[model samples]
Structures are given as C-alpha cells and as structure tokens.
Target: MLHPRITRVALGASVCVALAACGGGGGGSSTAVGGNSPPATSNAQITGKAIDGYLSGATVCFDNGQGACDLSQPTTTTDANGNYTLKVSGDATGKQIDVLVTPTTVDRSNPSGAPFTTTFTLSAIVSGATQNVTPLTTMVVAQMNAGKSQDQATQAVQNLVGSSVDPGADYIANGDSNTTGVAADMVGHLEALYGNGPVSWTLVQATMNAYAAVGNVEGVQQSDVNTQLSNMALSQPIAATAALADSLYAVDGDLIQESSTGAVVSPGLSPVRENWTLSGSTLSITQEVQSSGAWSAASPVGSYDGWFSGNFIQNTAGLGAMLMKTDGTWTNWFPNSQLHPAYALSSVGNNLVGTDPNTGDAITASYRTIDVSGQPLSTALQIDYRNPVRGSMSGTFPTGTTAYLASTQHANDQLMLTESGIGTAQSGSWSASYSPGTGVYWSSLSDPTQTLTSVQQVVGTQIQVDGPCLLLHIEAGGVAQIVESGASGCNYANEPISFPVAGSWSVYPRNPNVITISLPKSVGGATVPITDTIKNTINAGGSLVVALVNGVLLSGYMLPASSVSTVQQFPATVTDTIAAAMRAAATNIGETQNP
Candidate 1:
C-alpha cells in the first residue's frame, strides 16, 4: 500500500515540552529581554539574531498575521549588533513562531550601516532556545507552509542551492561562513527583484515557491543566487509535491546478503516496509524505500550515529545517552552537553513520536524485534541458545531528534538475526540491487495473496513478482527470469522479468508446512553441492514465498504468469505511496526548476 515517501535521516535535534512555536514579522510584541523596559522574569525564552547583515536596534517579536507582533506575546529590540533575547510568558500555546524583524529608522547593520525600511517575515521552526531568522530559512518555511513536511522542504531547497547550504539551520551558530555569505547576498538579490531594504518575507518566500514549482534540477547547482534564480522565469507560487530529488531517476530493490557483521546494526536491519506471510515457515520482507546513497542523514549540516542496544540509545556522535523508559516516556539527559538546547520524547504504540517540544510537530521512529528461540540461524546448524537474540530495525524520525527502539513488535517480526563470536556477519548490505542480480538474489511478499489454494497446480507454472524495483518469473526446474528496470524510478511492469536458477524444488519432509528452496552456489562456474534454506517459508496464494540474505532482505510472493492480466493483482506501485512518489518522480531532480 501507499506510505509517506521518505528520505534517509540522521541526528534528530528536538525536545518535547508543553509549549508550541509559530513565526511572524513585526516587532511590537515581545517584552524585550535586554531592551526597552526590563519587565518581569519570563517563564520561557527564545533567542535569535536577524541576519540581513545583523540588523541592530531592530524591533524583533513573534508576528501575529495582524501585521505586528501579538500584543499578548513578548517582544524585544536587537542590541548594537542585532541580537535579541526575547521571553515567553504564560501558557505559550500557539505563540506565533513566525518572527518579524521590523527595522525602524535607528535599526541598521554594522559594517555597511544599511538602514532598515520594511518588515522581514520568517518562519521560525525553532525549539527551546535559538530561533535565528534569515531569508534562506524563509524559503524553507515557505515550502513547509505550502504543505511539504519539514524534511522534504528543507532538503528540496538544499537540492536547489548547494549541498552545503541548509535552509533550516542557523549558519551563524553552525559557523557556516559558506552559507552565511549566501544569506547576506540573498537579501540584496531579493530586494533587487522586489525593490528596497524593507523587503517583506512574503516577497522572498513567493520567489522561492515560484522556483520550486519548476520540478527537477537534475544536477543544477548554483552557489550564487543571481546566476541561479535569474535563469528561470518563476511561475506563480503553488503547492509543491513531496518527492525526493534522487527518486526520480531510479527505484530498484537490492538483495544484499552479507559475509560478516563488522559494525553493529540491528540484526535484520531492513530499510523497507515488510510483511510476513508464513511466520514460522519462511520469512519474506519486501521493502519499498527511496533508492539512495546508503540510508544516511538527509541533513547537510549533521549526520546521525547510534545503536539500539536493549532500551538505551547511545549517541556514538557524543550527544550521549537517551534512555527510552518502560513507562512510555523518553529522556534526553546528555549531561554537560550544550549540543541540543531543548529535547523530549515519548512512545505511542510501537512508534516513538514527538517533536520540537516547542513546535508540536509529529515525526516517527519505529521497528520490530523478532523472536528466534526455536529457530535455526540457517538450515545448516542449530544454535544452542542461552543468550539474547537481536533482530533488524528500521523506521522514520526527525533528522534532529527521533530514534528507533526495538524490544519487539506484534506482527511481521521476521528476524534479521545478527550472529557474533564466530562468522557473525551474514547480513551486510554493501552491494547493489541492479539488473544482473550480481550480489544476492532477493524474494518478496510485496503484494501477498493469502495463496494456499492448491500447491500442486502452481508448481510447474511460470510465476511473476512485482515489488520495490523487483520483477521476476519463477521457473520450477530452471534459473529465474528477471526484468531489467532501474532502482530509483521504480518504473517496472507487473509481470515476470528474467533469470534461470537450475534447482529442484520440493516440500520439506520433516515439516509439511515448509519447503526446501535449494539456492545454487558456484565457486567458479561449476555448481557446488550446497543448499541455503531460508526459515519459515511456505506456499501462499499458490506461489512460493521466501526471503534472501547476503543477496537481499526482501520477502516476495509468486503469482502465476497467466493471471497477471489484471495489473492490480501484482501492482506496479503500492496504493498509498504511488500518488506521492509518482508526482515527485514527474519533476526534474532540482528544486528550483521543473524538468
């Protein structure tokens, strides 16, 4: 079915507090922390600087759509260097996070001494402490306001600009002089387009949104805005579809059965949505995720590193330990670390969901830990179990804060067992999932049909599979026939592809519910006498459902080729994720212009 089309993620930086955040463009609101009159000590505070050359003496406050900061909310004025430490009082629910930078006559920049004339609006997706405002982030927020998720919007713009420019980050704090210079130049360029220093954020945002409508940029990287935004005739801004830049070219399925477990990941760490048809018979997992550079952080400014060991998640990147409690609540007690200003977490069902403790946006992190007590690591040998077994884990979380927890799950818990001590690395995914099926052969249960109708009738027939970038035909006594389609676009048909595996298939004598899929092994060109039997495999919908490791981590099902006339039976795209994925695939690779 259809799921939210996603990109890879790393380091999530957020906290869960009671308050929420919004953005604005006026300076009449906040009770300025260090300016105007020192009122009372505020309950909450938000700090930031206006980076249009650092507007000093500028009035900064949470804008309320009313053209000014809400009188009910707090307000402040930037010091000599354009820095404002504002306060939040009362039940800070729905406090306009849209920061408004109103430059009065006295408000001016330092070196250049440029005078402020108009209001600059910016969407402040800020959390606990810092909420820096700039024209670049306004572009990101414009995309967010148009309906794309934060990650999608952030990355889309990043693709538009250079990979080094992050629209959602604080360049000043991150010390990104590269992007900081880009921000400085952006204001002058936008003002040139719209005319004047009193440039409204709306003008800047509309300009960005207009460019985003162009669809794809394939490989258009313009570090300078004048050269980039100048080339295209931007259309009237419209809502952008949520598609990743890489997903447009290819969408292929990979079968990577590893030779060893070098570094520790979840045992069976599959990066796709999986389904289990025959739990104890054979484990099948067909995952459909964006085909990209090994699922890593989508953020240009940061990357993520940690392991799901029992309950605690240790941030190998020095963020320290995040303890996920049994009481359903989570804690980010990184003692003596000022890395993340605000952070909080809690679990909902199998998912660990939370957001900008201040913004209240919902992101996710989830996984299933399989139970393999009575199971064999493979059909070759049975391990005498006395220790804890681990399974593979996968899910989505904010690039800044969300993390996965894997004690176990209710269904589809086919284990991706990680063996250690001796020859313990059988599930590594360092190969490719291309046309030749070079590394490992993968099977799928992508569109399962509870097929157990009659095993005898389906045995000698040709069967086809359609899942991820997977497409193939199953032959009873020969090599498999597979289809040739790229992995990123996922534009394959619903039919048998190609391949020829010469092997004799038969039902297991010991367990009537299982069967032996004697996968052929060739040391050179000659066939070797050995069989790799996957666990818990069975006949469902009259087709063999099996899984592959080292070669792949998918659980595919077989459908007789004759019945493939109905496209829906073996769908080209899952119902839920297709609309979004296809819409994105239609656009070119870049964010500024459609291909």
Candidate 2:
C-alpha cells in the first residue's frame, strides 16, 4: 500500500456581495463607525451565489470579535436563490469577521457524506450591505472529498480558485484582509523552500489585486473541474512510469557528510555525473570516476517495481553490483551474496528524488532521459541534483546540496572541464567514449601550462586515462578530481615540464558553453591562492566555440568519421582580441574565485 503525507494550511478569503431591499426602512442609514469608537450595531444583509448557482438553504456561520465563528452570534440560511441576510450585533458590527459556509447536502456526489464547508473573512458589516459569496464556495465541494489527501485537496482548491475567478482582484476589491492573509501563507511556504527573501504581505496583496481585476472571464465548468481532479489522482503514476521505462538518464550531484546540528562536517567535493539505463524492467547504472592516475568503473543493477504514487516509482528488489566485464564479458564478484536492493524513485518536475525504503533516507536529485538514437552532440542540456546525506543521526540526512550536470555529447563520446578556486588556476578536463558492442575508452588532460596527457583501456569496473606525460587512475562511479599533474616521461615536447593543478570541472545541458574549467592561482608564492575559471561555449550544432573568459578559453571540435582524426587539441592561444583581454586581466587572474 502507498502512503502519502499531506499538510493543510489556512487559505485566504474574498467575498462578493449583492444587496436587496424589501421591508427595510427606505433612505434610513446608520452612522459610520470610527476606528477608536465603540462597536456599533447594524442589521446587514449578506448575499451571494453558490458555486453552481445561488446557494439556497445553506447554513452561514459568522465570527464574533473573538476569532472563532461564534455560532451563538447572529447566523442565517440562504434563500432559494442562495441569498442570505444576517442580523449583526455586538462587536461583530465594526470588526472584520470570518464566515463559514456549509451547504445543506454536503456530499454533492455521494449524497450521504458529511457537510461541505468553506470559510471566508469578511469586513465590518453596515446596514443594507450585500456581498457576492460564490467565489468562497467554489472549492467547498472539492475540499469535502474525504478520499483525497490534504495536499491534493489544497491543490484542488487552488486550482479551482485559479480557474473560477481572479483571486488577486477579487480579494482586493472585496477586502484587503483576505488578500493579506492569503499572500502571507503563500510567501511563507515559498520562503521555507528556497530560503528567505524580501517577501512582504503588502507587496503580495498589491500584486494579487492587480491580477485579480482580469478574473476568469471564461468560467470553468463543474464537470471539467472534477475531471481534472480525477485525472491527477489516477493518471500521474502511470504517466511518470511510462516516461521512466527503457530510458537512459544522466545523474549529476554532490555527496557530503553533515553533522547533527546541520553544520558541514566536511565540505563536499566537486559534483559527479553518472549514467543510468533502464531496459524493460531491469535497470543498471554506470559511472566513470578518476582517482590518482587511473580510472575505474562500477555498474549497480536494480529492478523497477512500478509507480507508487505522486512522483515516486518503486524499485522492488535487485542486487546492486556490476555483473558484466568492461569488455562486455560476464563476471560475478558477489556470487555468494544477494545484490538485491530496494528503493523508491520520484521525478519532481525535471529533477529526480530517490529514497531508501528501509531507512527512508531521501534525496532530491536531477536527471534527464537520454535519447540514444538522437544526436547527443548537438543537444543543450541542464541536470540538477539534490544529494541528501545521512548525518550522524540514526534516520536522517540533515545536510543537502544541489549539483548540476551540464554538457553536450556527440555519438557516445563526451568532453568535460571545470575550474574552481582563485589566484593560481587549478583545473581538470577529461574525455570519454563508449560502444556497447565494442567496449569503453577514456583520456584525461590536467595541467596549467604543460601539454601532458594520459590514456588507458580496461575491462569491467577498472578504467584508466593514459596520455603523453600524464596518467590518471580512475574508476566508474568514483569522484573525478585532478589527482596528479606534472611531467611523467611520455612528454612529446621532450623538455621536462610540469605545473601543479587542482580544482573541479563540469558540463551543463542548457548552456551553449558545454564545459567549465576552473584553476587556482598562487598569490605572491604558493601560500595564498585564488581561482580562475573559463566557460567553453558551443554552437547550436553542439560544436565548441572559441570564446574568452577572463582572457582564458579552451575549444574543441569533432572530426568526420571517415577522417583518421583523434579527439585531441593541443593548447593554443585564442584570438588576438581574447589574448589581449587575457593579458589585461593577467594581474587580476587570482583575485577572486568563480562561484
């Protein structure tokens, strides 16, 4: 069984009024009460239409000055046309009061269910005042559905408000109190998610009022509203699951260790990117990680257990280790142990959320389904991840951070570079290509001035990038950082040369600039350091564009398949304009690091 948690927050109110005079005195008016004056008494007629039509025979409860809707206070029932006249007395006369509208037949569909209720805040009532209250009751029936979760109900109400009327203008024209309260609640929720900002009630109310004037001119039908709610409840899981099947997704994010008090115990390393493939009911994830002067690989296998609810997809059980060799050969490292693991995956918008079913450890990550048949080289992409780490607590990963995987790929090959810090430039770059029928290949180039390269080939999880004067140890599903940089003999230039380099690199999807390279510069000597970063822009066709970043740039392109050209480009100066900019900014190279 699937369980969903929903939270209910108070909603703002807006009232529409209509007035009729019959037995009331003609041309008889009551004195307007002042702010500080004692409360005045008045017999007010509150009238409004219901959602579908006039709310006749509906019970209306009004609030006194004490906050709660004091049923003992004056109340009334709407006439056949959904019109109600209330007789106000005591403190309720001069103060804004809350009104709860309840229909006689609560269950519009079931007929036997409990009554449906809707609340709205109305201002001080004067004699002969009429208000349209249809907007308030629009969501009453939806909220009354006992089968839906609170979140779903609230969302339904919000949708109803948006579809039926213009909340901004309606609330403002009716009264400022309703607008203020509603805006407060919405802004509060936003602050909790993306951190606090300059959110104020006054600003919210003004914005809402401005938009509400252009209300829902094309009124929504009750049947359409019900259909939308029903569709959302039943079709979300099926849609999400269909989108996930037989897809290749790229994962990019960070891994960190945080303390119980929500402080960073250790700053996370640079972000990592991995690829996952879901073939039918089985799923396998592969990652290439560089460590020291070598590269390695890892493939964790799992199975899908269909959709749970909302955005979540369940993974029933599966072993979590690679069973195939990097050369497409078979190998069983965990022959004696069950590699099956269970978890849940959910996609919230464009991002992916994964949770540990056993421990309930959840992470909000991001991924993009890869179209293998499409031209990968020309597509601009953006990947986001929310990595939730397990803290010192028993069942919590209090610390979380967002990471991005932005890059352009061609065929089955990719090149990525990123820079971090300031002063002395510390940067790293790597390229990889894979063919399922053949195997996998990779290379790396990490140095400030020297043209040192490393390349390697391996079968299974072990991988390497070996090049002239450079050799890096790496593994699939491992962190990629510049582990070593210097002259290591394979120098094509022959003159011994080396420069220590460090930092991080990554590729973005949406950005035309596919790669980011960051390097650290030494201040004075090597004690104080700063960072210099460069972003390599790409054309719409996914080819690299030579552009300057603080006077530094790196550019690469692909060669035709018929040509005997390798994916290699020696270090070269950019255009004179860019070269001049680099010289001009040379003195300020390590002043500050790129965030």
Candidate 3:
C-alpha cells in the first residue's frame, strides 16, 4: 500500500530564560486633583529605568489570576534611556508580582542562557490608585550563553522521521556499550565520518539514507514517524504537481486560501490535483497543481503529476510501508527511511500532522485501514488549486457622521465610510478583491474642506490608509497612486513650488481664520498677503483632520466650520489669527517625497 513516511524528534533539555528587572514604583501625582475613590479591582503600573544595559522591544506583563502573564496586552516601548512604564492591571493592591522580562528574539552571540529576570512586589496601596513599591536593584543585565554544543541535525532528522534509534546512555563514540544494531550502525557511521573532524554535508546525506532505509528494512512501524519522512520526499513532487493542476484546471487554490484567511501567505505544496487507486498489498498515488500567477492574474500557468506504488507491513509494533521513487530507488515511507535515520518504529507510529522543524510545511495524515479482507490494495491521487477568499472590511467612524454616503458594501451591517463636510469626520475600509473581472476600491469624498485620505500601496507591505491615522490592510503590492476628484484641499494643477534654500515660504492660507502675514521676498515670487479660502474639516474634539500643505510649511490648526459662512471669503483678522494657531500647533511640513 502507498504509505506515508515516518520520523522522530528529540527535544534538548537546555532552555534559555529571559529576564527584565524594573525598579522605582513610588509615589507620584498627576496634575488633576481628586480624592481617593472606593477601591476597585484593577491593574497598577510599574515604572522604572534600567541602570545599565539595553532592553529589546519586549512585553511587561502582570501575574493576574493566571500564573504567568502572556503578551496579549498592550505593551509600552522603552525609551532610549531604558525607562519604561508597564501597566499591571490584573494584579490587586498589595499583591506582589515577581515580574520577569524575557527577550522574544534570540541574541545570536548567546543562545544557551537566559537574559535576566527580576522580582518586584506590589507592597502598598495609595488612596484611589494602585499601590507602589520599590524593587531591590538596578543594573539589569541579560546573561550570555555559556558554551554548550548540541546535536541539532541528528535531532532534526529524528523529529522528521519520528523514530527512536535508542542511542543508548551517553551516545558517545566508542564509549557507551548500550549502543548496537541500527542505532550502533548509524552512530558508527556518524563517528567514522565526523569524529575528530567537522561533520560535512556527506554525513547529513548518510543520515538521511539511514532514516529512509527503516521501513524497507523491517516490520510495521508507528504512524507519526512514517508521516514526517513521507512529507519531505513529497514536497517537491507536490509543488510540481500543484503547478501542473493549475495549468490544466485554471484554478489557483493558493489565492482562494489567502482570501478566505484574509492573509497573503504562501500555500504549501499539496497535490492540487490527485487521483488514487487501491489494489491488493500495493497502493498507487498521483497529484499536480498550478505553479505561478498573482492573486488576480489568471492566464499563464503550469502543472505536474507523478505516480508511485508500494507494499505495507502490518503488525503490533506499528504499520510499515514502502514506495519506489521515480528514480527506481526503493524508499520506506513508514517505520523507517534512510531519508530520516535516527527514528525507529516505536516513535514512528505516533500519527499526528505537524510542521517540519526545518521547513514549516503543514502536512496532513490520519490513521486509517489501508487494506482489508486479509489482502493488500493499491490507490491513486489528484488535486486542484483555487483562488483565495475575500476578507471582511471594517473601520471606526467619527461621531455625527454616517457611512451611508459611501459607495461600498459591508460584509455585515456595519458602515465602512463617512462624510467630508463641516461637523463631520470619517475613516473608510474595504476588503481586497483586485481582479480584472471584479471591481476595485475607487470612490471619492467631496466637501470643500477635508483633505482626501491617502492610501499607500507598497510592493511588499500591506496596503494602508495614511492621513491623521493609518489603517493597514492584508493586500499590499503593485503600482500605487493617490488621486482626488471633486473639491480637494489643494489644486494638483499647480505643482509644489520648490525653494532653493531651507527657509520658510509664504503662500495663501486655506482657511479664513489665519490672518495675512508679511514677509520679504527671498525666493520664487514676491511676498504678498493673498486672500485664501480653506474648506477643510476638523474632528469634533478640535484637532485638524489632516495636515495642510501651503508653500513648504505642513501647518496644523483647528477650524470650526461654524466660524465661517459658506459663501464668504477670508477676512484680514481671521487670516492673522488662523496663522498664529497653525504656527502654535505647527509640526514639520511632512517629508517632501510623494506617497
């Protein structure tokens, strides 16, 4: 019967711990004044600065009811000076928490030991806020890896084959007497080839061959071990086959999966198209799929497919099977295969689908009766690829505005757009379904005042909406363009005037609130106070909805639509006041590069 390959993995006992020590959790006062309210169940804050050493972007968690805190909560970034403030909301007042910080990323120079972790207890409770306590020491530092060598390659092969060759106690060369048989032979080979010297690529090949020889050499083996080996041998063939299936069927399953999951992930190589047949003690399998094209591009494509049949060995130790490769070489898919050596039958039978430790591939397999009626059987296989599913669009809308005026369909009842005129604000969202046959997001918001929201489409990053805030989407790539139709903040016809020197340039104000300013002509045109009209909108709370571009200054200001009548022009008094306000809230004019 056509069976899957088996492999095993041995986890090392070494585990590196990370530590984050914080101090200084004493009394502090906010500007606001209020009496202590009733004690409420809540989280507190731990604020401190590291005396020495730097901290990576790691999370600071509290031991809320859970024994250990997870990275699900929002974490603050540490400043350049190593100062940080972590909100420990789940812990109660007076309840001490032994907070330990762990570095999520490994420090290449040191991998064996943990960085550093410190303990701090919540000692006292302040009137209405969380209690504060001071930690013992500072000089927080991460530990370095104390030199220790591990056999990762051998362990990886074992994991892949899901078998245990019983390396015996202290699997050292010519030292341990427990090693013998297949285990001894494989060890001998490794020692002969690697002892007193560096292990070369040849040793890896020899290890693989030893693993692959398992099923062909003995009786039935475990299911888990068999699956791993089988998966490795099948990856390339699966990719080739899936590519072929897409060519013939005109289906791109990768795209379909992406759309469904709302993610742009590379799909695994499974037979996009497969056919199966079963006969006596042997089984045959074949499969194929499409190899190329964007989520929308549907024309050019390719496909591949192959066949194989093998025998199965059934017994208590486990189920074993063998298959002949396309090259006429015999490979055991179950129990053992030279492809993955270290594992044996006992470890191979644990049938579970998992990803490869080296190459993350979602492999699948299940325990099933491949044969019955006291006889053997054979089978064939095929697969087809399809497009990705579309994701749901969602966003937050400013109050007093509705999504009704927008032209887009929401997956549910929620709105995805808003208004652009006075007393209004908006944010928009839409799913990615860019295809030649389908429509793309192309709509405009017109209200004289608010700047058109800019959506950036970079080649590799996710698509994102940029303005006052940024909204990232799953689909990002290809040529990017931003254009506004109808009433806009600026006239595109008049390109941005460049200044030879890095100084200020005078231009007309968009709103009547800014008072005209006087300046001597330095570059470009002569300085003059021009009566300009701004139709921009503002958030109800009084922040500019978007930055205004005038000459070279990226000015910000709060413009109350109520301040001016629709038909009136800017007065001298309004212009002067508005300019001052813009200057007060002024930040950089923004980078010169176009989005």
Candidate 4:
C-alpha cells in the first residue's frame, strides 16, 4: 500500500456463514455470444477448480454480463475439494467464457475459514483450455472489461503482478503452494477486506469494481493491492530468504554472510553459514546449520528460489513472471521495506512466455541465449524462465532506508553535445576532457573507451539495453537539482527480470541529486560496475529509483555534476538549500521528455 492505512478486522467472529447463498446455482448449459445459433454438444463440459485457499461451497457460473445465467447457461457449485465442472456445449467452444465465481463462497485457505461477502471474481477464457478463475485471472477480466483483448489483458495483469501459474489449473490440487500460496494471499486480502457481514458487502464489491476501473478502493492503489497481497507473502518469517533480501542469514548448517545491505558474501551455499548481525534493521538473523536436501520451507513472505536482480529481490512474483533460469537452487530474500512486497514463482512448462511490455506481442527476455540451429535449444533458456534477466538479484540499501531517487523520466544520452548549454560558461571539468568539430566529447571517467559520441537527440528510454528503467525526462534549456523521485512507473517488465526498484539502488546521503547504485553483474568471473548520475538535487520525495544503464557504464558522475556546478553545492547554506529546493519544485516547460 502506498500509504499503509490498514485497519485489521476480526475474522469469523460470528458462526454465521450467511454468504451470498441467495444467488441460484442452477444455470445448466452453454450460451453463444455475438448471436450465433450453433448446434449444442450436450456432453461438452469445461473442467476447472476455484481456490481462494480451496474455496468450497461457492457457486460458479458462465455469463457475458449481457444475459442472465439461468437454466440455459452452465453453472455449478464448488465441490468439497473446490473443484467444478461447468456444463458446457460446442456453442461455448469458440466463444469467450467469463467464468464467474460468486461471493457467496467461503475460504478455508485462511486459518479463519470465513466466507466472502458481496465479492465475486471473473476470469475470461481465451481458449477453452484456460478455464479457471484465480485472482490473476480476475485482474485479467477487469482488464478485458476495460477493453483489452483477453490475451492482452492476461499479459497486462501478469506484467503487473508477476508470475504466470496456469490460471486455468488448480495450484492447490497440483500441490504447488509457491503459486497457490500467492493465490491464497490474494484471496485472503480480498476476504479480509470483504469482511464477514452485510456492512462489508459494498466495500468488497467496490474494491473489485474500483480495481476493474484501474482505480483504488480504500486508499489502496491497484499496485498497492498487489503489494498488500505479496507483502503478506513475506509477512511471515523466512530467515534464509530474509538474509538474501538485505541482511545475512546464518542458519545452523547453511552460511550466507553479508553486511546489513544485501551484498552476497557467499556465492552458493545452501543454508547460509554466517554469524550475522544486521547493521540497521531488526530482521531475525540466524546462523548456518548445513544440511543437504529435503529442507522444509520458510514462510513464503520474501522467499524466492531464483537469481538475484539487485542487492535484494524487490518483487518475488514479478521475478516469477520472468520464468528465469535457475540452477536447481532456491532461496528467498525479504526486503525490510514495505513498499517492495515479497513474492515467489515456479517454472511453467519451462516456456518463458509473456507479452512484450512495449508491443504486447508474445516475447521472452532478449538477454536469453540465442539459437545455434536457427532456434534456441531447450537448454538455452527459452520460455519458462530461461532469460538471464529473469534471474534472482540482491540489493545494497541500508535497513530502514525509506527514500531513493525515482525517475518517471530521464535523459540518459547515448551521446551528448553540451545539453542545454551545459558547456556554455567556463564549461567546467568535462569541457577540458575533449572538444570535437561539432559538439564537445566526454568519455566516462570510469571507462576511457566508451565515449559519449553522437548527436544530442534523446535516446529512447523504453527498455533499450542501456537506458534508465523509469520514464526518461530532462529539462530543455535549464538545469534542475532533483529528478522525480518515487517508484511507481517502472513498467512491470523490469525483472533483471527487467523490473524497477528491482534494479540495484543505494541512498548514501539524505537526498542527493546523485543516487549511486551498485548493480553487480558477474562477467568473466569479475563484477561489472554500472553507474548513473542525475543532476545535483535529490528527488523531491525520499523514494529511491533504480536507474539502470547497460554496460561500459557512464559515471555520468561529473557530467550532470556540471549542471549543479553553478547551482547547488554541498554543505549548502540552509538559505541556499531552501532556495534550491524551491527552484527544484518550480515547474518548467519543455524539459526533455525522452520516452
């Protein structure tokens, strides 16, 4: 939740299970949509399961929101096992089916075993093959209702929430709690919000409706709702995963050694072996107790059995969606921060499939291996999480650290020729570096070879190999101190997993225009250091933004530094700082909006 104004409500307070038992469970056949009177195949039925923690005693029906699901339609109540076989016919074959799970359902998944009131979920069937209604599918339905094609809607929701379980299959029945666990959290939160009586019916309905509208109910952002659910994933204790997230976990047998910030001191040791003491947070640190296979699971809260993205694993489900390749290794990391909720994922057919964030076409991570025989071999990381970008990542931020620079936009130039007369007066230190025929040339101080040599046109900031993850915006003629700071718009496709904040980040001082991030990539057995430098002011908000630029990195260190050469100075007088802050807040027109 952006602002966690949570009000914990009591569950199962009354023995009363007066759910929406009022809704009839008798709709019995298939109905065609767009009006095609095709012959019906009476024996043709759709099979699936409904599990908000194995929701039994609930009614499932088929409807297009246009006609009533009476005896002519297919409907059935969930079995004691939460399974349902909606009676269908050939007419339902080509048509899109909105499998509706009415709120009159009760959740046995939560310890409370309460019933949902006034809350119903809808999942759109793209093909008869996908005939299930999970929370992820519910979001897909909302997106579809908002006008996206079912495929588009499904990808959109997957991108946002992360992970792709066969929404059509029952995770519970399949014995996959990694996914079912996430589903339970999703269901549990909705149930908690729905509460147990007539008074909460409207609240529950409004949350679903508002969520469908891509709006918030009860001060919750849709992302917040996702976070609330995922945060619940890490709300429990998983010390091993917890160490990977930010601190160190020294289990009796396993030894993971690291400082407070999530830098992995151990390469690949099951059950970390460190006598760790977290520097800043109150996270539970345990010593290693090494044992081989057959280990029991920690709380799913922040536990992720994947590769590291940053110094921490920002979003477990988000990474789960990547379907990244893993080495049969598994662990979880809990970011002490609440904004970045915890999640987990498992392989789905090993086919890493997802909608391209920009084009919406089926695409896999570009960083994954290419073909040797004109096609990627199964061993080369195809669908089902084979992308290198889909691996687990650790982060390097202090515990209890709240804010970092966020970029809704930025101008990470491929080449620069004195942006907005940045080289106008004195031209500072970089001006002395190199002067070309047309524009000035400055090579990154970190690497003398990679020169900023090109026209000043803004590089597209949309997930290109070397670009800031957030939207990119830069002022045209003037310089500003802080870039927009707060993490919201790192389009869902930033798992390293190409997702945002999932990017490595660290806030050294209060809010400096310069946000230094340590994104460690092991190449040829050594770590590659990539750096990004914004101008001279910290983001207005204390929020951290994960700025990512692919290799041969630029320490834009002193480049943007010149922008503040004449404007902002450290140990700045309080009056000067306030003046600069006011200037930073001032609205400027025509700033570079390099999308």
Among the numbered candidates, top lDDT falls to 1
**Candidate 3 lDDT over residue span 43-161, tens digit each:** 46555432112233333343232212345553454455334566655533333222332323211212233332111111112223322111111000000000111233323323322
Candidate 4 structure, TM-score to reference: 0.32
> How does model 2 score by TM-score?
0.24
What TM-score would every model get versus the actual structure? Answer: 0.29, 0.24, 0.17, 0.32
Error of 1 at 216 (Å): 12
**Model 1: how far is 329 from its true place, Å?**
67
Segments in model 1 whose C-alpha atoms lie over 4 Å from true places: 1-43, 90-95, 102-110, 116-118, 164-168, 197-201, 211-595
Candidate 3, residue 179: CA error in Å?
32
lDDT of 4 at 471: 29
User: How many clashes in candidate 3?
Assistant: 115
Q: After superposing candidate 2, which stretches have Cα over 4 Å from the reference? A: 1-45, 49-52, 64-68, 90-103, 106-128, 136-305, 312-595
User: Relative to the unseen true structure, what is the Cα RMSD of model 3?
Assistant: 32.5
Q: Summarize candidate 4's per-residue lDDT along 254-331 as a digit string, tens digits.
A: 122332233443443333122222233222222222233223333222232222211112212111211111221111
Distance from true position, residue 269, model 4, in Å? 53
The numbered model that scores best in TM-score is 4
Show where candidate 3 strays beyond 4 Å: 1-44, 47-75, 81-83, 89-285, 291-364, 367-595
Provide the overall lDDT of each model, using Cα atoms, as 2-decimal numbers. 0.30, 0.25, 0.21, 0.29
lDDT of 2 by residue, 1-595 (tens): 0001002112221221111100111111222111222333343444333322223454554533322345566666656654456665532332332233332422121222323222222222221244333332222211322234434433443552443233212343344443333332332221221111121111121112211211211111111111222222111122323334333333221222222112343442222223343343333344322223222332222111111110001111111111212222222222111223333455333434454332233433332121111111101111100011100101111122111121111122222211111112223443322111222221222222333221111101111212223322222332223233344544334321133333333442323333332322111111111110111011011121111221233222211112110010001111121222222232243221111
Question: What value of lDDT does candidate 4 attain over all alpha carbons?
Answer: 0.29
Task: Judging by TM-score, tell me the better candidate of 2 and 4.
Answer: 4
Q: Positional deviation of 342 in candidate 1, in angstroms? A: 60
